[model samples]
Target: MVVEYEDSLEESSYSAAAHEPQDTARLAINASRQDDLADIIFLANNRRVTDMVASMPHPFTLEDAKALVKRSEAGHMGNTLFAIRMKNTGRFIGAIGYAPSMEDGGACHLGYWIGEPFWGQGYATEAAHAMVDFAFSDGGISTLTASCHVNNPASRRVLEKCGFQFREQSKMRMSGNSGLVNVDRFSLTRSTWKALKAWGQAA
Candidate 1:
């Protein structure tokens, strides 16, 4: 899918962070919507549940949001974040994207969060599946990895539902904020994806 957005930064960099899986059929990752900051801030600030997302907290201020927009616009952080919008409402319901890994070639970490009001509606699953498909198909990525805080079962379920397998336990030393948190690593491979599709068809 050729997902185009007006907020795309002209400059960006990417690298592999973890074990690179060989796969095809990756999603077309893109940038966040520039003009929709007000709505993003409103949803993010008003929704306490959104605090589950690392880096964003309840009462997210405009200052913090401005920084987010700036970082997204700069596009040099190796993180390709995109806003999720409803085709009908054109409202920004959430965000999802891949953070290029610093450790391995062709490997990227997936991250996403949805607004509180939109939970349990399958949007997260659909968006995540689209991203996985892009990573494996379009990005030519062999392996895609994601980490969720040990306490975040919903996030873990999202990853598993999309075919990622539990890999290992690890800790994330997040920058400039929360010190450290236990995280669970999950991964998916091209062969596994193929098998998943085959299995789906069989079922």
Candidate 2:
């Protein structure tokens, strides 16, 4: 299930530029959306999509969404995992953002998910590009890491578009489960970010 891209980006080459995250930039990232639990639950209950998620459990409810909002808000020191919303309709589509590990002070992990109804419309790529730009900007990032199940081609594509380079492949225990699953890790550094910005401008 571990799919990798032939291309690679150096962490030292991406430029760190200030990028104002816009809610209307294809997709929006929101946090502290405990009030939107009902909608979140509705989206979470979509069996068509959750079947693909590595560790997401079934029968999502309003309470589950509320707990997610609460935990995501209070868990990370930098406040990761924002709600993903549509710009035009102003409807919550899913969630996105970085999650930091206490074990790795300088590294942060990026993750996201979208409702099935919103799939295959370029929202993931758009939001991921924005998130990467925001993270690599000066005063924004030290290092960023992301991973996906080997079978998650769409997720891998999102990482590729964000200029991440494959670091390694390993197994990790899934949430709400006891077994291990294969995953591909990708990483980016600030200097590479600067270069990436320059390349983007030149292109």
Candidate 3:
């Protein structure tokens, strides 16, 4: 899923380090950089990648990548943007973060996308866990909302694994596809996230 938001907040940067017990042990959620533009364009230009995202334009150009980086630097309505990277190699594999859900009162909207080459790996889930943890613990978000194209089961699984509950299905215009598409919405509250964390720790 992709998210684009407006309004402004002072820029800030932080990192959320995650240690996974499986193959994704090296994942790190860090701020996007100017250096990431080339990599972003390369990975995001694929039709397979854009079709599943809502706002990302296909043929993802340098200008598009630059605009994204600028937004990350500027911060969007209390939004936090992170680059999903390999801690060991410092390679940008994907992007994930959240923004205030203006329509949902105090809720924040979570969104993410992984490169085509990295599909089927657990990187998305691992990064999502880190983002969710950061959102609740450090980002001061009381609730998180996310949505994905109805056909994208991979994304649905990521949200499910992260404790988001199905909320609804709605239609939205996808810029990448240049048409309207059906999307499934999901939400996770702070209390639920805390319980899940406590359960995991207890286990």
Candidate 4:
């Protein structure tokens, strides 16, 4: 399924400067660039990374990375993809985006991945937060869903941190495993996001 953005939304709307205090910001999300091909190939080719994602193919190659950048340029499955870049150096460290889901009511699915070298540093959670905000505020989305392999506790933590609540357990085809795997699904609604934002401001 492909989630379609409103025609009123421009490509520039996908660019987000996440985390406050520009100089102190750790990262920013922006449209993917051709220059990011080498970095995407280098980071995405790792088994440790692709193994965690469902659609990413193992033995990831330069052509695959080039296709990814092209998709980002042209819109991947009707969804805009973003590069997760370090604020200080402007280096691409990962990718993140939302896609259409089979779920009723126009719910979209959120997905992201970071380089193996950048893991354990809270990049996933930061990116998730930024993406969630962007989806609700700028993307005109009402519902967002996500899932992670049951064994990936780190990913589950990232979803929970972004205010996604557990929904159900399901099976999905993982390209790395070449079979269906158990996954834990989660979802968040616009109302819940608004409440969370209010609570955070009050706190």
Which model, 1 or 3, shows the larger TM-score? 3
The lDDT, on a scale of 0 to 1, for candidate 2 is: 0.67
Q: Rank the candidates by TM-score, best first.
A: 4, 3, 2, 1
Off by over 4 Å in 4: 1-24, 76-78, 103-106
Scored by lDDT, the top model is: 4
- After superposition on all C-alphas, the RMSD of every candidate to the true structure, in Å, is 8.1, 6.5, 7.4, 6.4
Q: Write the per-residue lDDT of candidate 2 for residues 76-186, one digit (tens) a residue.
A: 333456677886666888877776754345488777778888888888877777666556543446788888888889889888877789988987655534467788888
lDDT of 1 by residue, 1-203 (tens): 22222221111111233222111132222455567688778777754444356556556778766766665555533355666777555677777777766533447788787878888776777778766655554335568788787888888888989999998897775432446768788888867865775566556
**Candidate 4 lDDT (Cα, whole model)?**
0.77
Number of the candidate with higher lDDT, 1 or 4: 4
Candidate 3: deviation at residue 178, Å? 2.2
**Residue 199 miss distance in model 3 (angstroms):** 0.7
Worst 10 residues of 3 by lDDT: 1-10
In angstroms, give how far residue 150 of model 4 lies from its true place.
0.9
Q: Per model, state how many residue pairs clash.
A: 23, 20, 0, 1
After the best TM-score superposition of candidate 2, give how far the Cα of residue 68 lies from its true spot, in angstroms. 2.2
Local accuracy of candidate 4 as per-residue lDDT tens digits, 4-110: 23331343434433321111148877777889988999999998888889889989988888888876776533256788899889999998888887643457889
Candidate 1: stretches off by over 4 Å: 1-31, 46-51, 55-59, 67-79, 103-106, 174-177
User: Candidate 3 residues 102-164, lDDT tens each?
Assistant: 545657888899998888978888888877766665334578999999999999999999999
TM-score of candidate 4 on Cα atoms, chains taken together: 0.84
